[model samples]
Target: MEGLKECVANLVVYLHPSKAKCPNEAILTELSSMLFTYNETFEGVVLAYDPGNCSNLAKILPGIHPYFGVKLTARILLFNPKPDMLLEGEVVKITPHSIHAVVLGFSAAVIADEDIRGEFKYKSKHGKEVYVSKSHKKHKIKVGTILRFVVKSFDEEILHLSGSLLADHSGCARWLDKNSDKWSQADRF
Candidate 1:
């Protein structure tokens, strides 16, 4: 969530001669192909796009194929997580050695045992696995729980993230929000 942002870009979408009848649709289709993939130019993964101010007249190149370029201003939503940034995700799987979560319902994140702080201990309850905080019994992480953690590294190729739970400010997001005042007061000492 921390890395999500919107940016405006001036783009030229090339269209084949056959698609000249509906240039708008052809442009949309070309931009849609960029969704959910990492682009080095944008330096992030594109989540969504909106094309605006399209030119009715396109420039037809002199090539034999006669491809035309449609110019437009586009708004793009991108996700580009960086090291030490705090991020939230849903716990999809849990084990003694590692915790697996999905960030933004797309990126996969993993927090290994070493990355998890010593304040929490892994345990089983009702045949369910969880990581429980030793200091705060109400604060725990289990499957489906929304967790906040620090980003250690990210693999842009596969949209995979390496996360850590070593900060006092990181844990169950709901619990942290609900008990913000109390947590802050306790953290002072």
Candidate 2:
């Protein structure tokens, strides 16, 4: 949620000659192709889009196969994560060496052993594996838990993220919210 941003874009969509009869539909299909994929021009993954006004007049290219360009405006939502940014994700898997999570129900994230701070200890009880904070017993991270972590690196090609729980503000989101006062006090020292 922290990295989600919405912005307006003015774009020109080129439609093939066959789709000249239905230019609007062709434009919609072209915009749909951009969803859920990382675009360098946008600098993030496109989540959703709303196409705005379209010009009735189109410019047709003077080539063997005529292609027409339709100009339109659109609002798009993007997920752009940056280093040292705090993010929240749901834990999907856990191991002694790492924790796997999904951010915003789409992007994948992994918190490796070296990135986990010393305060949290990996434990197994009744066949369930979890990371429990030694400093605060109530703070725990297990499968299905919502975790807050700092972004170490992000792979745009695969939408994979490497995260860290080394910061005081990074941990179990529920625990952090419940103990906000106590957490702030700890941050002071």
Candidate 3:
């Protein structure tokens, strides 16, 4: 019964069905618009939304009929990551030859030195040279500094990021709030 309730919580009602029709074309268009939004936004994923009670439906149509219940249907979207994909992440850690970053809720990334424009190399300690980027020297990635990288290889959920193409600051962009438009608020949080 608990599982059943969980499943019901995720359900959405599809407004339109095949062979369904309404007298008003305008109302039909609105329904179609809602349906199309669900289809495209989720890439065919099933979800739920609470549109206010259909009191308007009673007004538009000349009937005492009222919608007692609503049911929606949608398909699930699949996960698909592509090569050479550009993404922004945070500087989680820095190593001698590589930088580790976390992107899209996962980790184990190795950023190529050439791709990181913000990183500055410097030596530290008792003649034992230690290389650290600008952020690494501070021991923390500064807020608003969005690290950008290209997907060199993704295998078994591990991504190899390259900074080679980003060497000239040509690839890396500034703060995401002002510089980027690709990642939406929903995608970020």
Whole-model lDDT per candidate: 0.93, 0.94, 0.40
Best by TM-score: 2
lDDT of 1 at 120: 92
lDDT of 3 by residue, 63-150 (tens): 3543222333323332223446565666565544566665544434566655554445635456443333453243222323346656
lDDT of 2 at 35: 88
Residue range with the least summed lDDT across 10 consecutive positions in model 3: 1-10
Model 2, C-alpha of 160: deviation from truth (Å): 0.6
- State the lDDT at 62 in candidate 1: 86
Q: Which candidate number has the best lDDT? A: 2
Give model 1's TM-score versus the native structure: 0.95
Candidate 2: tens digits of C-alpha lDDT, residues 1-189: 578899999999999999988888999999999988999999999999999999998999889888989999999999999999899999999999999999988999999999999999999999899999998999999999999999999999999999999998889999999999877997899
Off by over 4 Å in 1: 185-189
RMSD for each of the candidates: 1.3, 0.9, 14.4
Model 3: lDDT of residue 8: 19
Model 3 residue pairs with clashes: 12-72, 13-71, 13-72, 14-72, 14-73, 44-75, 114-163, 115-163, 115-164
Worst 10 residues of 1 by lDDT: 178-187
**Which rank order by TM-score, best down to worst?**
2, 1, 3
**What are the runs in model 2 whose C-alpha is more than 4 Å off?**
none
TM-score of each: 0.95, 0.97, 0.36
